[model samples]
Target: MVNLTVTQLLRDRALADPEGVALIVQGSAPLTYGRWDERSTELANGLVERGVTRGDRVGLVFGNGDWADYAVAFFGVLKAGAAAVPLSDALAPADLRFMLGHCGAAGVVHAEGLEVAADGWTVTPGVLRAEASAQTSYDGRSAGDAVTDPPRPDDLAQILYTSGTTGRPKGVAATHANLAYGCGGKRRPFAHSRHLVHAFPIGTNAGQTMLINALDAHPAVVTLPRFTPGRFAALIESYRAGTVFLVPAMAIELLNAGIAGRHDLSSVLLLGSAAAPLPAPVAAALTGAFPNATITNYYTSTEAAPAQTIMMFDPERPGSVGRAVAGGRVRIATPQGEPLPQGETGEVWMRSPAAPRSYYGDPGSGTFRDGWIRMGDLGYLDPDGYLYLVDRESDVVKSGAHKVSTIHVEEAVFGHPDVVEAAAFGVPHPVMGTVVAVAMVVREPVTAEELRLFLTGRLAPHEMPAQVVTVGELPRNAGGKVDKRALRSSLTAPADLAPAHE
Candidate 1:
């Protein structure tokens, strides 16, 4: 009966709508609320019998099982008064090793196929679920005999690692209050529809957000384990999903692949994008593709859950991410840590009730101060308080005395008809201090000179990339964002990179 815990929420939904489809993964069986609650209870009781104590950290490694499996393990861990640690099925062996060791998990509850290598563990609840099918005696216990313990509102619910764009991923310790707010509660914006769809992968912050939202928002939560633009569009039609979510990278693929055109997306009423800013070009294309739908772009970080900025695509203010939502505040500050004038670009800081998170067991990033987070984004706020991002402060290139937005250059390159993917970065230069460079993936033949010419009108003379390297593919992180750091460190580093003309 804990109001703030995920366990209580799932139980309420199970009692109210036992037969409602709670989860659906591509090519797998649907899991109803009743079954979801039952499996979680069973697994929870099993974990308790196997000696998983309150506050114990249990890793979830569902490895390609239905997303429902991850869901069951997540709630089960919470129901047992244990914190859930979701392991990405896509993580490298080293990353996986680091997480397992870093969290000091007492046990791991993984699918039959998934495995984790760690030195020692006090428990391994994998056998608990593995033995469930054969143990009728295990489920024969009275309702009161199930796990009697559940996490409190302020208890650690999960530890999500950053996507690690710049360096090592840091674990974000979130309490039950943090993850349980939007779920199984009064309906909110994205959750109001009967069906909700998104292709977010497991282990990413956005994926965890959808998981939290799925509890009570929609009657059906349709998910794509793997996202191809065409597959993403087809699923919307197949399920007649009214609301769907896409990150910027996914949105770009949908537009360039022309997938939404191939499907009957008439059922879509809301097409939302998050994780990163939706490129102006991508935003425009989304509007055209889902003409019947309201296209929205949201800006928020993993650590700053529920506190976000939302915009419904205003062509007049193409770059604006919109004003802060309810309970959220945004401010622009100068590099010297002073508030900047409206319309002046500077470091962006945001604050909300949900912004009180800290890095678990690692030196803090110093991004979070007092009640606000630095956001690490450089942008301006208009007199009306609408926010517009220019670029990440660390990622922008210094050209001569002025800073150039690689995002701007990349957006222009993405606008090229033949370009499927593009990235812009700073390179060492003798006279200009540093110059802009680009790497791109194209579907058709296009000369570097042609692309260079294309940017002349779209970007300032100083902002134009001096070198462009065409590639078959651009590196991407598991969360689906382009790995700009990886790109900069690759053999294509501007130092020795050849121009596209060569």
Candidate 2:
């Protein structure tokens, strides 16, 4: 087995080119590998001195503005042989508290100027870095003395909390082996670019993936403080970033704001969309926006990292999310965990090449079985092995005897020229038990009757939306995914009377 750890990659990079730029936040100075290594080493030793031990979980609370420090803290936790639990500054205080308690965190490392009150010890990265400096200068001690035992490949590296759309957030624990599975290879990920730009917020799986890319990929990772259409476009144009990554919501906003019309984004050679499926319409618009880039959609969950189906936008198969690549396998299975036939819709399952991740406190979440992770998605595999997603298992509308896919309904709504974004979900009905309903955002004013007319031939009799509500924006979770549960709660009024719709 090829044994590797996450810190090993960073160490190799720091040794190879100490002066090379490693990370950069927009409007901030660049962070070099030499400094990243030095700072993280000191912080690791400081953490070890402050009672952190192997297998202990440390909480990292940070915002996008402090991404460089967050990066250093992440490596420091690994180097200290402690599992890092990262949480966003944007998360609610209650949620943050819940996650910290859930993991029984040993200590907390928060960003400067941010207030996080944990039951255990809490310190900012600046404070840790300062204390390390004092110890080195006054005591003439090296950080390596404290961190005698470096982390091994099998050691716990991180515990990331999921965006709790259903119940309380669950912590997913991953080992150093899981995070460093695909690294230490001859070919670098995103090798076509000098600088790769993205606006993914800190604490999400997508954000962590970009963090790993910063350590392993050839490109210098560039990110904005936050995702605004104008700011994101400006970063791409200014950096002439050959590689870019974004989710569907950002893609919709960029297209709606006509960012490509105003900015020179032709330098992008590889554009990746993740977090959620890229709607066909948005994917097509991205092709025009980044004329020189290959628009790719990646499908993977937080539990199934490094195991994803990658689809380069193909006009012939626009709806497919592509086949599993890079030693990952995809399968459609029944609820009972039995494999289903091709073209048969069922639960989606994926397996990674690395050690499978599991829930931290609760081992039997039923999401992971053997080595495969249940995706909680309903999809079917075509003859060519491409996977086509229908909808979330919970989001699928069970209208009496007929089942409705929200994706199909939304795709039809996106076919209209006026529609900017749309979300479809199930609504309770007396006669049908549950019926299809839609919430949409459009560029121009359009009534429910007009949308019904637009979807008349596009949908079947049962597939048509029973109610259509127009909203200025769709509610999103921390991970930037549309919160269907929130939408369902908001549309609890009279069915005939649509909210914000005439």
Candidate 3:
């Protein structure tokens, strides 16, 4: 079993192939494995000199640049026996404050150009870079000065905050073992075969997982400083990358950018889509674009990744989320915790060794039952043991006595020939309690009456949207999922609303 900490993971890679390219960022210089490890060692020494101690929390706020520096910072913190807290740079200042305060971070390490204002103390990237390069004097002791008090499998390695789409964000405390289980423990029929092209921000769980798995398996990872369809295509062609991981929105943008036809991307072997469901049309477009690649979509959350089912497309199981990986079990249960049979829609619950042990600083219990974690998602498992997601439990629209899945309505609307994107939500209704409302972006003019009629035969009476709002674009989060709360607020204006039968 692989019991080493993330710090060790880097050290091992450094020892095995010091000259191999460990990180590459567009518009920046590449960092070799040996240089990456040595820099991390120096950063560790710097942190030690700066009073960073074991079990201390170090907050990191940065974008996807040559993050090998931050990796060194992370290892330095870990080697000093401290936990790392990486925050997405996309978050607003207020949100960043909430996360930093919530995590009780001792200090922060921010990027050179980002706007991060913290009260106590903050370390700039310049300082770490100078220290790593031995151009600046550091008072902290080196890793060799003190015996390594590395973290155990159960020790907390990092605390990641949730996206807070539904409610207040909760901190997910991931132990070294928890992350390792996600990286390697879950059973799969296939070994690591694809070179991953990661475009997500490194602070997020998706990025961290990609980093660990790539280093553990020594996959050639092509990094993009920022996600641009053109740049992504260029990297894939330049590196002859075999696999890629992208959110649905990025995939759609790539399709719109016409990068597939412009580049020689036939070397792509597997295309993995996660963070959100890939619309059927988008998935189809990708399949046509990358004909040689297999499309695999996984359903998971930040709290417990690789949790639930992974749907690898098969002709027989069109929308199935494949089967549960080893060391994990999935159950569909009612709100009352009653188990539902196959084909019955219910909340999806997952139990796995990789699941989060507990929410950081959350006193309330019941997040986990036995070993199962409530996924907060609505879905059903088919008779063939394939999982299908409908929508989030919080996003389900309650109209009078009926419950409607917004994703279903959105999917139907998006299927329209002229519609580019769509979102469905519940609006406060006087008589019905709540009514289904839809917001849409279209490529051409389409009347509300036309859309209502288009969906008449496609959706049930209760599922039919009472109003359709036309917009140029839908509000989205950093992960590219629809920001329904923002969409709800936008509908409050008079000009934005249109009658369904208009």
TM-score of every prediction relative to native: 0.92, 0.97, 0.91
Worst 10 residues of 1 by lDDT: 493-502
lDDT of 2 by residue, 1-502 (tens): 2688888888888999899888999988898887888889888888877889898999999999888999999988888889999899999888999999999999799998888989999998888877877775323556533364778888889999998876677899999899998887889888889999998889999999999988888889999888899999999999999999999999999998999889999999999999999999899989998999999999999999979999999999989999999999999998767999999999999999898899998998899998999999999999999999999998999887888899999999999999999999988876777788899998898888899898888998788887888998999988899999999998765548333211
What is the Cα-based lDDT of residue 48 in candidate 1?
74
Point to the candidate with the largest lDDT: 2
Count clashing pairs, candidate 1.
0
Clash pairs, model 1 backbone: none
Top model by TM-score, which number?
2
Clash totals, every prediction:
0, 0, 2
* Residue runs of model 2 more than 4 Å from their true location after superposition: 137-141, 144-146, 497-502
Q: What is the C-alpha lDDT profile of model 3 across 1-502, one tens digit per residue?
A: 4574666666767887898776667666767778767766666666666777777788888777747656666666676677888887778889889988988888887777666777647887568556555534434543333224566777778888877877777888877777666343333212444356768776676777666654565565668778889999888888777778888878877887789889988878788888888777777778877878888887777765646567776756655666687667788997767799888999988877563556888846566666678888899988777788888888898887888999888878988898878889987765676778898888899888899889988998888888788998788876667889988876654443333221
Sort the candidates on lDDT, descending order.
2, 1, 3
